[model samples]
Target chain A: MKYITTVNGQEYIIEIDQKTEITVNGERHGVDFQQLAESGTLSLLIDNRSLEAIVEEREDAWEVLLHGELYAVHVQDERAYRLAQARGKLSDASEAVVIRSPMPGLILDVLVEEGAHIGQGQTVVILESMKMENELRAGRDGVVTRVHVGKGDSVEKNQELIAIGDAEEIKEQQ
Target chain B: MDNLLIQKFDKVLIANRGEIAVRIQRACHKLGLQTIAVYSDADRNALHVRYADEAYNIGPPPATESYLVIDRLIDVAKKSGAEAVHPGYGFLAERADFAQACYDAGLVFIGPSPKAIAAMGDKQLARQTVRAAGVSVVPGTDPGLSDDELIAAAEKIGFPLLVKAAAGGGGKGMRPVHEAGSLSNALAGARREATAAFGDGTVYLEKMISDARHIEIQVLGDSQGNVIHLGERECSLQRRHQKVIEEAPSFVVDDELRRQMGEVAIAAARAVDYVNAGTVEFLVDRDKNFYFLEMNTRVQVEHPVTELVTGVDIVQEQLRVARGRRLRYLQDQVKLKGWAIECRINAEDPYHDFVPSTGTITAIGLPTGPGIRVDTGLYEGHTVTPYYDSMISKLICYGETRGEAVLRMRRALEEYRIMGVKTNIPFHQHMMESHRFLSGQFDTRFVEERFSMSEREIHDELEAAIFATLVAHQRSQRASQIVAPGERDTSNWKWYTRWERLQR
Candidate 1:
């Protein structure tokens, strides 16, 4: 089985011929992988060196936290990668992006209202969490399709705070 | 104070959460005193609740509805039969009204008097009081100075002064003006920010102490008018005006400087009639000139560093002072024997702009060995919510010298691990290895201006890539494995029995 893994914008091709043998980026290495009893923990021996990591599978990537660093690793097998490339959709950069609450917190302010045009990197909402005020910014330039939350509302992690979409795309959806 | 008039409490109620609550509980338990814990809905299963002898639910998670509610805390104290209330730093710790409420409820507050708290809690009032006591203050205009008056004062104070809010801390409504040209605009902006943050637009002007270090003296005063200083803690390493690291026995302070600062700190505390455990903070310039900054009327967040070096359980002393006990140690008995450093471990993403991280901590690997101490509210399977401060733990290391302490901290930071949320561990790790930090140099502005987190990534990207790929591959293999029933519908044992019967 062949897997293409992208970590922090760097891509590597990994091939697994046997349970104990693998190659990464055209470099052969003997490997032993063991999933520990602890959920999301893995002990891997690559080329006779021991390394440990906590790996969680998310919707689009396997999240790995190693050495106090967090990374979302996107791993796609050969068939899936080729199919994605063939569709001419190698990235989802131009799609609508929803500004979600990163953590449970009290909404301090909603800087943008529905139908308000916003620019990339402009703060859209301010949420008070962990004893500090955090600004949620727009990922790209677009009109706010919907304002799902308001000031003083307590929100859960991943709940939609607002959505940004193309004016035409928003109209079509409505 | 007469020994016969001692006020002893059999039980103590901790009125805060997180590591400081647990720390005070330890002190109470050490003196054979029972500890009662109060929790909000979000902290029903928190570690501090489990560590106490009794736990009471106050209210919901939001501090306003629970932790900061004086009636809820007092009710819990009365119901639990706890005679004393220890308000750990934060929450209602610095609120003078909370202290008064405790006294009104016939409960001893394990901190300064309400009068003392109020006097020191007001930033402008504290400055005036300390200055009247002959303590050197950062040359600043008095509170209630008009914008025109402030501008007038700035000219005398010289260029490069600070416009600061008189009502709050943590760098709110603070702006630095390099020249007279921008003083008016700066004052307006600061006033607006101050109004929004503290509800008080009162601002003051002060000479900005460039290249300054933050050094604070720990003071223990008994009800019998006995006061002693416990040396100093250097807390210059900061980010956005928040202390990230602290150390005892500042690299720049010698015996003479410590004595001078100690005397001035005592003078400041006495000016407010301060009693019990408190800290007098100062800003020290490069020339060793010190100025009274403020007085913290409760146990500080970085108290462990002082504990590790001085071998003094400050919380216990606070309990004793509340009980009317005389000072246990004289001023001459205090000593800063060795080097101790502490790093505040917060649940924040260091790779980003230190955004708070929260989730259930699925696993924790604590570092243990010589010279390493971890005071934390975190445990395996514990959830971290955003209803409170981001600080989850304090990691303190001690040794005979600063070098060894730094080495120990680096080793311990490397050994520490937590799962299920991002942490500022990478930031602490980077700081421990930086040459500027190891040399006992750098000031308050070092973290923001001189320090960068890009180097020393210890990039385990290769391993992360392999593990992620292997995990995906394993899941796929498991999905492809067919677990169909045996060839025959009948059970294997029944088929074997029929074959045996035919043979017979």
Candidate 2:
């Protein structure tokens, strides 16, 4: 089985075979799914040492407790995984991009017009939350493609607020 | 004599809110003084407001409209006919103008003289004054150092120095420069922070002493210029320059060293003509040499440890000093005994980068024993307001020795509990169990460097089990209480209604 894991915005492709041992980022580990189900624990061999991790099935995910660290892992079969991969490819080719709210807050001000040019790290939006004002900056130099929110808008964590794209990227899409 | 002393002023109006308000209220009641509390609209049911003989709403929730409005506070005092006002520790406590306003209004301000506060509040001037009084200070640029002069001074004093705001405290407006390459950037950063925090962009540079311990001398001064020190407190256990655990009579100090430090603190106080209670802090190195840090002109958060061992009511003494009283106890009469420790319990999630936790305190089980005391402003159903400091309580424990004190503190923590709002109590418990802390061999970076979630696997496992059990119980209860056809759903409807209420 192959899985894609994204950690801190970085992606890694991991493949696991039955009873096969693997080393990840310099740490050696052996994984056996069959043994895991029988013992209700997964035996992990790390750095030539053996450790046990408790695994439990929760709603739509597997809750794995390794050395007391709990991680909610969403597992998918081959068919569903392939569909997700296809969707990722389509999104990668699209010029329309979503900007995520960096933190939970009320949108106090939106500083850019729909077609305004924005330099990298330029403040485009101001958010007020927890009694502190934080400015959201442009991640890359680009023209403002669209504005999804307005002033006095209450937004949750990761809600889209703006869209930006380079002139070259937009022309290529057209 | 008794009749004359008790002529008037039975109730002391606490012109502040939060932990310090509760602290003053406790002290006032202990001294047979009634407490009158004033609050804003948001604090109608606050713990401090409830603990007073009378409560009145001043204004809205914002501090500028309420706490910092001197006229409103004075009006409340006058209306209530309260003679004295205890400003607690923050808000208006250290404001010299507020103190003067209280004096002009014929209300006793339970703190130092307005002159003393003004002199100490300016960090650069206070540094020069203390140094002139023969107190050793860190090698740094004096007052009125230009940017170019500051850079030159940094080069002379060497790298790894500190850039500090002259008008700031509380670990704000500070930057550490490790080398010449980072000097310009650090200075700019420090200046920006200074402006943002204190409305002052002026900063000063100092040689950052490596492996130094933070030890402060608690001093008491009277109207007659008599000042005495209450030994030294070891506040070396810090995170980001904020103290976590503080102990009195440091492990390094002997009788001779204590006497020397005490005399230096007294000299520093008298040099500024300081009156009332103040803390003269210092940075002590391994060679027994100490450099004066700064003079805190107001009451400190860690005053409980000093009071525990010395049997002195610092707040009451501050009131007496403001009333033109002489020193009640002479220098030779002061005696320190036992070991005392204080842990600042902040409403922060230790697992989540210590982010402030704001919510209602659903449940609380405070630690109580012969030697344990919790100075807190929170109650079981009180909301941990996001508009104020994250700190909710200060837990102090006293014993005959440091070892006993640590053991007692561990037990006290085990017995303590607070739900619905996250706290740093778990971190305190973990530190109390760490070998380095138990042996007193830790430094300022101990908490940051030593403890991690992965390092404490067993404790994490226990926590997981407890959380799992709690969740499972809630699920089971919900399943069992499912309403059948024709059955009333009163209790379950309450939960649903409450959730709907929050959404609305």
Candidate 3:
């Protein structure tokens, strides 16, 4: 099956056959890959050149530590890619976005209220995580349609905390 | 000479956490002394707690409520029957009050005398004391001067002066003024910063010594008035006011200068009647003129570099001195053998402005071999919390030559592995490969103001693209090998087997 892999803003088309032959970005290469049974180390021999990498599967992507640097890779199959494309269009058409927690933390305070218009970079919430206070800001000019969290609420990684709608769209909804 | 009665302690309590605490615990165990550890809520599962002979929970995660609280520390020491207290560098190491409390509690404080601590804890007083001892100090304003008086002092010091907090260390409340017009503003800013950082707005003035090397001397003094210096450590590599790398026997100091600085450092310690382990730091100029900086009243974080070169265990020496024994070596016996380098591995992202990274360390593989030592408080599945300093380990390497030491450090850094948190390993790797670093021509400002890491990232894009493709390809293979629902339920082989069974 062919896959679309995006790494650090660069996209590549990868095709694999029987786990031995692979082509990346239209260049065919004989690959010998094996996952160590005891250790999570990945051993790969691409075109007879050896490479060892530590691969960790995070929530949204695979984080590969190769040669002392971390690279985040996002992979999607054909069906999933098409589904994601559809969802992207829907979100773009509505012109609304949900602001979520970047990491697990307690809400120190909420800086915006429902129906409050906020400009890009305006503080929306103060999150205390890892013993440091981080200010979550509005990514775009919009009106806060709903606040899903309050002061002192415990939040998880990527948990949606606020809904932001276009200034005109929220008025229409109300 | 009053503490010469040979006060021996059976157990020592370490009033700190993380790698330093672990390091002290190892030293205590080596000397056959029992060690007791005190931890906050955040360090319940810490490596130090597990390494100690006994452990107690002092309080919550915040240092103020736990590590910095003299009362809590004393109570824990008492409850644990610890005969002495070792406040390893940071939390209360330099606090004179804490040392006095330990003395008042009838417990041996494994550091300099409280009087010595008090004398050197205040930078203003320390300068005066060192100067009286005939040790040259960086020309700075005296304490208790008003704003106008300070401005006048700055004028004499000339443009390019530093407004420093009298009670400050660790670069917290320092501002550099480059001209006469900005003196007042710089003073106000420094005052505000000092008030916030050290709770003292008292400011001082110092002529800024550009391109000076931060070379500090490690002094060990006994209660018998016998003080000796353990050479010097070059700690000029720094960022965000924290020393990231250190080495012993600076390239700039020759035999003649080493002897002079060593004698001056001993005099500085003797001026305060210091006892136990302490460090007298100095700033050395390009022309080899050394000026006293300050005296750390306890074991320092970079003490290992001195130990590796001098072949002395400083923590064990602290224990011995607190037990009223004289320093094992006299001035004539003290020797610097070889070169040593230390790199502090902190859980900070070098690519992202060194922001603190905290999480469970899912995996770790420390370097091992001859001439490489790793002092760390980490284990697999251990958590790196954000309540304390981000330093996770100190990797030190020693060799007969500076080139050998640097090469060994590069090899060790390459072998080190850590997962689930960002670290500054790449920064160390880059420094190891730099020509300036190899030549030993850098200052404290070299990291923050001058050094760049962009040149090291040239091959990252190509490597990342290839690795990503490989990972995707492997993942697809794994997915294909898993049996589907229809394939698991019925198979052509199974049907054929059933027909053959019926015909038979």
Candidate 4:
């Protein structure tokens, strides 16, 4: 069986086969899906010892409890997994782009029209929260293609504020 | 002083928010006092609002228009028909003018006298009053001393000294100077911080001890002028001057030392003619000698640890005291029972520079069973807002001895679970397992020196956890897909089929 895993925006391809035992990330394990189902548990061989974990499905993700510690993991389907791998390859070629909240706030002011020209680290929006003020800064010199939200908005964790594309790169693509 | 008694009222208006508000509401309910809560726009759905019998939104999110606005809070108090107002710990708790407003409005204020609050609110004046009461204070000049005068006083007090704001506490507006060369800079910084934090930059000087333990004596006073101390609590485990863990009965304090500290605390309280519940804090050194620090004229966050050991409901006592009742138990009658430990459960990511983590707590399983008490303002689905203190809950454990209490606390921490937001639970778990902490051989700088994870360590741990998660995720996916269809063939290739099934 072959599977692709994405963690923290990074992707990895893993292959498991019987009699072809291998260790991944320092944890040695023999792959046997039938044994795992019969025992109702999966055991990973780490340092010549077996460690068991109970996997449970929880609302669009799998929660694996290993040694009394729980980990939340989001799994991607085959199509999305392929796209994520492609995205990973493209990211390696381009300069890393990062977006930061301009202000320490609730992001009450996002003034950049999407697909607008923005300089590197330019102040794109203002965040007003906790009785203080902060400004959102752009990641790199690029053209904003999509604005995720507008004025007087509330954003959750990792909610997209804006999308940026390199002007020269977009021109070349067109 | 007229007898300010709380006439029989069904409900109390808690004109505050956060953990303290929830604390007061719990105390009120224990006494059969229903609570009315008032909140700002930002805190309309806060835990305190949900905990109260009734909640009203006063104004906008800014504190100036809501919590700090005396007129608005009074209006809410009136509309709710609440007979008394409990200011909890902060916001309006220390505001003498606000307390007087409550008095003038014919509503009972569940705290000390406004005059007492005013006297103690000014740090320097409180020191002088405590000194006059024969309580040994830190060797420092009174407020209004010139720089030259302060420098000379510092020399007399010795090279290492502290320049503190006369109107501030909580590590604010305080500077520790080691030598004469740093005096001017320290004084200037202290003044600026004092002005910004307390609105008054009047600075004072004190002898700074290189290693000091913060011990506070809890004092309860009645309107009839009776006051008594409920022993001491050692709160030296601090980070950035905020207490992280607090325990009752100092490790070095014996019966004699406890008596002396209690007497000084009582004297300090009596000097101000204080009423209700208050804490007289002190800085103690290795030799058992202690000096008066400052008087906190409101209920403290660590009040539950005291309640657990002494079996006294300090908040209920404050209400009873406000109602012109005498101390229910005498000073000698109050018995300090077994050890009690309180861990402040803050909504902070200990791995990330102790930064405040704000979000909804999706799942919460509080520790139950004997000897474990959780005083939390948050419930499942309660959003921890950035508008308040990071402390979401206080988990206290009590037992026959310190070891028993610590063991129980460790068990409680294991049983307790909070998800959907980053918390300091892991940090507490690490600290509880530390050798120094278990042995109680720690000081204020213990956490800073020992538990602080280096940048490299943080990166490594994050990478490892992420890798492990990804691997587990892949294994689970393969197993699920293989098990989707029921096809069992266990005849010829039993081991092969088992291995193949597990691989899925």
RMSD of each: 6.8, 9.7, 7.0, 9.4
Of 2 and 4, the candidate ahead on DockQ is 4
The residue-by-residue lDDT of candidate 2 on A29-142, one tens digit each, is 554322343333444443445544454445444444433234444443345567878888877544555566644567868999888888877888876543434567776788
Q: How many collisions per candidate?
A: 0, 0, 0, 23
B-chain TM-score of model 4: 0.84
Clashing pairs in 2: none
Summarize candidate 2's per-residue lDDT along B1-504 as a digit string, tens digits: 333444246668898887788888887887788888999887888889988988878898766677778999999899988888887765677678888998999987777778877777777777788889998998887645788888888889997888887765665567778898888877776676555444567888888887788889999998677898888888888765668889987888899999999999999999878888999989988798999989888888889999888888888787666656776788888898999999888776666545556667655668888899898888867887655566788999999999888888888776666654667877787778788877777655566666663444233332223223222323334444554424645544355446546656
Docking class for candidate 2: incorrect
**Reference-based lDDT, residue A83, model 2:** 86
Compute the interface RMSD for candidate 2: 10.5
lDDT tens readout by residue for model 3, B54-140: 999999986767888899889988888999999998778888899999999989999988888889987788888989989899877
lDDT of every model, 2 decimals: 0.85, 0.72, 0.82, 0.73
Stretches of model 3 off by over 4 angstroms after superposition: A28-30, A37-39, A47-50, A78-174, B1-7, B143-165, B173-205, B458-504
- Residue lDDT tens for model 4, A41-144: 45554334545554444455555443323455555545567787688787754542545432234665786896689997577865544432334677578888
Best by TM-score: 1
Residue pairs in clash, model 1: none
Q: What is the C-alpha DockQ of each candidate?
A: 0.49, 0.06, 0.26, 0.09
Error of 1 at A27 (Å): 2.2
Q: What is residue A119's positional error in candidate 1, in angstroms?
A: 7.9
TM-score of each: 0.87, 0.72, 0.82, 0.73
